[model samples]
Target: MAEFLANYLPAWLAYMVAGAIHVGLIINLVAVGALVFIWLERKISGRIQDRLGPTRVGGKFGWLQTLADGLKLLTKEDLVPGGADKMLFRIAPYVSFCASIAAFLAIPFAGGDYPFIVQHVNTGVFFVLAVLGLEVFGVILAGYASASKWSLFGAMREAAQVVSYEVPLGLCAVVPVMLAGSLDLVVIGDVQQGWFTNWLIFHDPATFLIFWVYFTCATASVNRAPFDLAEAESELVAGFHTEYSGLRWSFFFMAEYGSMFSVSLLASILFLGGWNGPLPITEWLGLTAANGDIAWYIGQVLGVINVIGKAVAGVCVMMWIRWTLPRLRIDQVMATCLKYCTPLAAAFFLGAVAWQWSLPGRTFFGLLESPAELQSVSEGWSDATAAATDEDEPEASEDQTVSSEPSRKVAAAKLTGAAALQIASTNLQGGK
Candidate 1:
């Protein structure tokens, strides 16, 4: 994009223009997406409990209700507790909000050679997790600055919960990265482009299991219901934001919703094939870069929709889980993380390693050939080598065919040691 602009404008101006576009798009997506999700959550919860929600406020579906609430918040006076530390109290929410928004900088909304991302950080996963974790520091500051016992307790719970869940969360996240061979989300999504079964979640029994654990930890990490001990309404009176109100309070909620979507986006990119749809309709229709820029443009548009749809589905599931399940005690929450999620994530991680080792080319739980049905190439290499005589021998190609590349590795296991050594010795003598 910058290059295109640079041809018509100054280099610096083109870069500035590119940056502004990214910033604008992300800010709007975060801000507007939160509004939509808030309204959607209310409707979902209402439906679950058998009632109408927010129908009178806007139009048919109460679409404008969240905007109305935003306006109300904007009109309200911002307050700081007299006993609180004014500096941190004033700044904490912005700190959290900024961290939440910054996470999207590394997150790609679509995937391809030129992905829709703000920054293509090499360690994209690492960068996102680190940025997301910084959000709790703001909550900690909010809790401490509020000078209320409830706020303090909420902040401490948040700190402990985030720290604890991060362990299993990181473990589960690593399973996909291990499979994808790159931390770049673009690469991860691209790896699963061919079919739904190629998605990392279905790569093996272990990866399939690991996806669930990841989602469980992510829900807890994001402080969604059943695990939202940080802001337990009955116990903490609004928790870390207890002493907050008005626009500032809204910022904290915005941050929460943003993080919710960010984590969901991350999960989609990792395990659900990011921008790739279940059926590969785009591929089948020949909508790819090779077909021309017009086709590529259409494909990217479809990709954007696929990505947003998957993310929205994930968020709705979270809302469903929130309303359906009763909240757990703090002890139970900690126990759930420690006793179940962590060990299961670790076990799945190990299982993926073993599966990759044993059935190197297998996919879709071994229903298809591992390494994408390369048996013919391996067999052909072995037959040609085995058929070679003591004289007039072909040059050795086993090492090249059966080296560590996953697609080329099946031949190594098939060739006997004596046969391989004989071929190697023949090549050494001939030097042809």
Candidate 2:
């Protein structure tokens, strides 16, 4: 029976199994992480306001509060509003959820030659950003289809904010990409492999400054607090998904939490050195690509733990910020992005470039390797450069002993006379 099954399946089926494993892992991360975050939010918000939150439902921690809520949502009647565009309204939540899920495909949960990357896109950074941008489409469609004035207003504001913030977000994101020289997230992460100082956040003074800008932009791009004018409960009254209920409503929350985790993952990649922990435990223990054991599942397990630790820490910080700060007005949010974030990000980008040029090998205090120089050195010896240099020299540079005598230009009158003679010969032949 085993032989028969093996014969039926292609040898590459193991890779398919690996892909399925990754998908399962990501889905669990999103679903389980959402459940935990929701419960934590309730408890934290309650404590901040001096109130008990959900002590009755589960235990001292109210661990099962989200599960209970999910149960209730499942049992609730799925209501479609009379004025709603039924098809579009119903489809929007899944769209949002799917977009969030798709963003995970390019995210690497570890660093190594054989890391736990799902799709391994060459343009992984852009793919994540582009897929993330698509999440807003679902929000806009939800608002339009809901046929509610408040929902429409909220969705318009969200669309504008997301679209606007993406500029600074992209600008800030490019700083790390410029420092790393490749858009592949795995490559970017791998570049920051040594110490905590090697992280892009500490690459230079300019990159350090850009880190904060990137954080702010990432927060805004994810529609978190201060920039979350879209779903300001006191103002928009549930916002774009106002008309949504039951399982549909849960889907929007899933998308929101999923996006929160996505941006946290992004931050982890861009600034936190990805799977490279501050302690370097993995490397210290001799678990790297150089060692054959790195190809084993144990390495993957270590990477997953390392990456998730950073990502969860990021998300927790975001939650802390959310609970601590007041939501900013839409105008204030726009002003911050355009007036402050844009110029700061631009200046930092240039400064980092200059720093790389001036101090190519010299690390600040000798704590970290200059990622820029490493990128430059790697690029210098690339096949593309070799090809270009060969193309530039038909003959070797040392062999440039050709004559330097000036070549005479053809006289315009002589060329014209030759043309006329040729034309006359042609005419005579035609006449004959």
Candidate 3:
């Protein structure tokens, strides 16, 4: 669309318009997604406790309950403590909300020649983690600016918990990056493009274990119970946002739910095959990237549905866990991260590396073999290298090509990590 507009309008204007569209989409996603999750949480909690929740609003199902709550919040008077740092207090929620929403810029919703991504950063995984880590700073600011001891304690706990969990979270996420050989989320998702068994969670025993560890850390990272020691209602009043009111308070919830969805979507892309369903229904229906624009568009729409459905499912599971489990103490939260999750994640990372070293080119406990899979994985990089080499030595004779084989082999042999995995897989499959 931006490119289309560029044919008539200035290139700068076209780019700006495209960027605005992307920003609008993300903003709506975060805002509307938070509304739905809030209502869903209320309904789920009510059902678990054998009671009706919000039955009066928007008919029997209470569809307008969240909207009604939003209105009420909007109408409430904004308040700040007299002793509070008014400047920091005023800006904290927006900071948290912006950080939460900014992570989506690099997250791709679908995979194709033109993926449904905003920025398409090569280092998307790291970018998201780094941005998400910044959210805690807002919490700290909110707590300190509130001039409340309870809020300060909550913020400190949140900082400790989030920082601790991020170690294992990064380690666990690296497992899929190692498998896909790219930090680009679209590439990660595309690499797992076949059966559900191809998903990173099923890649090996270590990865299977790593998935659970990732979820645990993810839960903690998002401040969901039983890991939500930062906002224990029985202990602290309302945690970091205790002194906030009206839309300001609601902004905090929006940031929370937005972060929840972001991490859940990240999990989908990393481990659950992103836009790919458990079965190849879209492929069978002839809706694919290769089938022209209409088919590609339809495929992408379906991909969006697939990815969002998985993310919603993850959010619902978190809600269930929140309502069912008891909250952990701060000490227990730190212990869970340091003593268990970190060590387990590190072990699984090593185990996955070793497994890839030993079993390359095999899947499903080595019952299936496909050497071409590994070749396909490395083909993108290999082709780029070949193209660059060809461009640099266009005048080389056939004799030079023959002489280059040994150097090419040496280069291939020097491949390490994911590249090594691909080469080893190819060799093992060839030997078979």
Q: Against the true structure, whose TM-score is highest? A: 3
Better of 1 and 2 by TM-score: 1
**Candidate models: Cα lDDT each:** 0.80, 0.75, 0.80
- Model 1, 1-432: lDDT tens per residue? 788899999999999999999889988988999999999999999999998878978789999999999999999988899999999999999999999999999998778898878898877887898789889988999999999988987887787778777777877877777666566677777777777877778888999999999999899988999999889999899999999999999889889999999999999999998898988899899999999999998998999899889989999999999999999987678778777887898789789767765665577654676333223223333445456453432322242222224221222222233234334434543662
- Would you list the rank order by TM-score, best first? 3, 1, 2
The 10 consecutive residues of candidate 2 with the worst lDDT sum are: 400-409
lDDT of 3 by residue, 218-329 (tens): 9999899999877787888988889999999999899999999999999999989899988878889889868888998999999899999999999998999999998987
Task: Give candidate 2's TM-score.
Answer: 0.82
For each of the candidates, the C-alpha root-mean-square deviation to the true structure, in angstroms, is 13.6, 15.8, 11.0
TM-score of each: 0.86, 0.82, 0.86
**Model 3, which residues run further than 4 Å from truth?**
370-432
User: What would the per-residue lDDT of candidate 2 be over residues 1-432, giving only the tens digit for each residue?
Assistant: 222345667647755666677788888888898998898788777877897777867878889999999999999998888999999999999999889989999999886677677787977877898799889888988999999877887787777777767766776677666566667788788878777777888878888888889888888888989788778888889889888889999988988889988888888898778887776677678766667763445666876887788888887878778989999987678778767887787788778767766665444546445555344533432423345565643432211111000000111232343334434434643664
